[model samples]
Target: MDIDGRKLKILEAIIRDYIETGDPVGSRTISKKYDLGVSSATIRNEMADLEELGLIVQPHTSAGRIPSDKGYRLYVDGMMQRTHIEPEIEEIILKMIKDRVNRIDTLVEETAKLIAMLTNCATIASTPSITQVRIKHLQLVPIDEHSVACVIVTDTNSVKNHIIPTPKAIDFNICNALTHILNESIKGSTLSQISLDKIRVSIEEKMKEYGTIAGSVLEAIDKTLHQEDMPDIYIRGANNILDFEEFNNKEKARELFKVLEEKPYLLQVLDHTPPNTITIRIGEENILTPMKDCSVVTTSYSIGEHTIGNIGIIGPTRMDYGQVVSVLEYVSHHITNMLREMNDS
Candidate 1:
């Protein structure tokens, strides 16, 4: 049967009702609650068509219909609207983000807590991978004629410094000149983009006459970039998953908690989320087997043009889509703005 405007409206009502009550939606309930002028009998016939079309499913012969994954997909794609967040909640998030935005760990922690409080769902946040971050500038401060301090700042505002002994007695003036030349060559390249061979060739070519400090500079850059303050995953409200009836089965709850506890699993989910927009992974759409019964809403937060990391909400598929979407969007935008302000300051 064709899903015309009428059929779409009926499908939408069923999904919305199921989301609100966490119960199967019947034709009588739809007829009573919605403004559809059709009789209950007429609506029941349409629901049958929707089930036949694989948009909804009947859990039992006597039970009403609940939206199938396909039905929820359609509803989310078209019918769902992000509700306006309360002004007070928005203010609370903005103030907190501005206060903690200077420190990444603090920001991630606060962000996870705020989102969990607002949405009442488990939250996960990841810091930017330093290797993936592009360099903004590299400065060298002369400690003496024999050693210099190399400070590299990434576009994400990550700073790393290393002190290295010069191969020769390079003076402060030479250190400044080398710093300028190094910045010109690799200023915008990510640490991963700066290959050892490429740096050796570039530096040697530029400073061939000055007895190149290429090897020492490359060593310092590598050490600074690989100093191994690994990107941390901050999770808040993992127990919130227990609040859903769908996770009432002990084994199911344990499985989800295991997924949450594993660093690799959390990393996979963060890596899969698209940057700069809200991505909703519903039920079977989730890549992890244990998360098949769960839904995840994710979006990336950025300091500027570069995306630093992602934040996600994990809950049962019956979770409130509109509210979660609004909260994530608000938090992501607020964090981005605060980060930019921090950078500017």
Candidate 2:
């Protein structure tokens, strides 16, 4: 249906009012609140036209109008005003980073929680995976005569530890020598390219007498490398979904809460979002069964050239899209910058 400029303005006003007050917006309310320079009757006629175009719907025969899914799509794609982050909010985010500079995981978790708190919505953050990381250092520290601890540090500066059993007790000096050999052989190689054969060859050539120890160390490294196939997802403020009056329906709210608890489902949802782009999924547009009554705004965060994970905020369908989109944009940009800095340092 074709919409003239006047009808579009009426639709915009109605949507804005409904979003702000969570109530049906009448033609008289728009005429009095916004100086459209038009009579109530003219505005009503325009609203009728917009309703006929499926942009707005009347919840009741005598009630005012609410923006439909098509209307929200138009507003988000064309009419919604873009908002800027406040300087004070930026300062708060910077302070959060400076306080947790030494702990990468803590920084990401806290940042996600803080965003959720600030925006009064559920926030989800995907921790960087191990596959995208290059091996920075690997060490095999002897724990006892029968076991050695494998410590793998990635290019992202995250460290993982594993223990491997040895056939016999080895002295500290011998363990140190074995560690040197392992590092020299595997230090510069990607985890995927490192193999047991290369490690066996290195041990046969250098540490022949302690080949058993070398075998155990290689096994531990293989496990650590494979661990990257599964990524971690962190969610905060899931209970906040209950606070919205829109979700007061017990059955619908329960289903949504159940979906949020499923990490794999959340991961799939986050993964579907485009890289470095802010995507907004409105009600009925969400593919997940339980999320039909909600809206999700998400963007992927990157470390250098590699897009690692996504961060998003979710709320009721009547969410403040303008504010939420602005906040999400700022958060995604800062998160990417922070991850890059962490990698560099």
Candidate 3:
């Protein structure tokens, strides 16, 4: 595809104007606002040629032109100026990670929501499955007469608490013994193999008086360990999607609203993207029906050697590619680094 330098410049001007004003652009507007140094008639001729080449399109017979999907693709892939995140923004993001250091899932969710709010775009983040999480340590705290709290620490340094009620009161010594026994047996095993029956047998053999306590603890561990399959999905600023003037149509707005609420649809969208790379899916390239008018930029975050989750930005096809891409890149890198530190800790 041979795009002349002048034609590329004209297309870039139209894209920039449309993105700024949310209005179909005309040669007069471009010639007036931009230093194209060309007459409106000459610019119009170039726009017509750009349109013929599928780089721009006229929304109506007399309306101004908007960049076609092809034009936006070219601008994003080849012409749009790249942006770097400001130092202040980087500081804020790092501070957020530090504040939520103990909670990796919360860290991911808050980071995505913050970025979405800052950028005025919908943000989605997926953390790695807890099923892949290995247990690092387990501590049992006595909560009350009949209940004990099971605190599980994973290899990722995430702690989860589960409270289990026993049939009767168990003293502190028994609780400590049970905790030691359970940790010794299940610490290195995957969650699925931490069978309650096996735990009961070990407890009965060790201390008959604490059999009931052991059983309850085993139940709690089973519940806590299996909890990893449900990965968290955070969507922030979904309402921002409606702010785009292009989605003023009631039907289009409703369709997008519904899709955003559907977790499976968002996961499918993220899953389609390759791991660990920023993917820019422009309008019509999106597989989802409602997302056809939107664009998505996504990249995965990892913990050391494993990809743990993905984070992405969602906006209109006219989204500022430079800003969105930079934000996603910075956020993804920061999240990965935070996760690695968390695992190390």
Question: For each candidate, how many residue pairs have backbone atoms clashing (under 3 Å)?
Answer: 0, 1, 0
| Superposition error at 85 for model 1 (Å) | 0.7
Candidates 1 and 3, the one with greater lDDT: 1
Give the clashing pairs for model 3.
none
Q: Which pairs clash (backbone N, Cα, C closer than 3 Å) in model 1?
A: none
Off by over 4 Å in 1: 136-153, 159-189, 193-217, 220-224, 227-230
TM per prediction:
0.81, 0.90, 0.82
Over 19-49, each residue of candidate 2 has an lDDT whose tens digit, in order, gives 8888889988998999999999999888888
* Candidate 3 lDDT tens digits, 42-97: 99999889999998998988759999999999998899887887899889988997
Clash total of candidate 3: 0
Supply candidate 1's per-residue lDDT for 110: 87
Q: Residue 180's C-alpha lDDT in candidate 1? A: 79
Candidate achieving higher lDDT, 2 or 3: 3
Superposition TM-score, candidate 1 onto the true structure: 0.81
- Tens-place lDDT digits, model 1, residues 209-291: 55367687778678767874467799999998887778889998998899999988998887787668999998999999999
**Best prediction by lDDT:** 1
Query: What C-alpha lDDT, on a 0 to 100 scale, does residue 7 get in candidate 2?
Result: 85
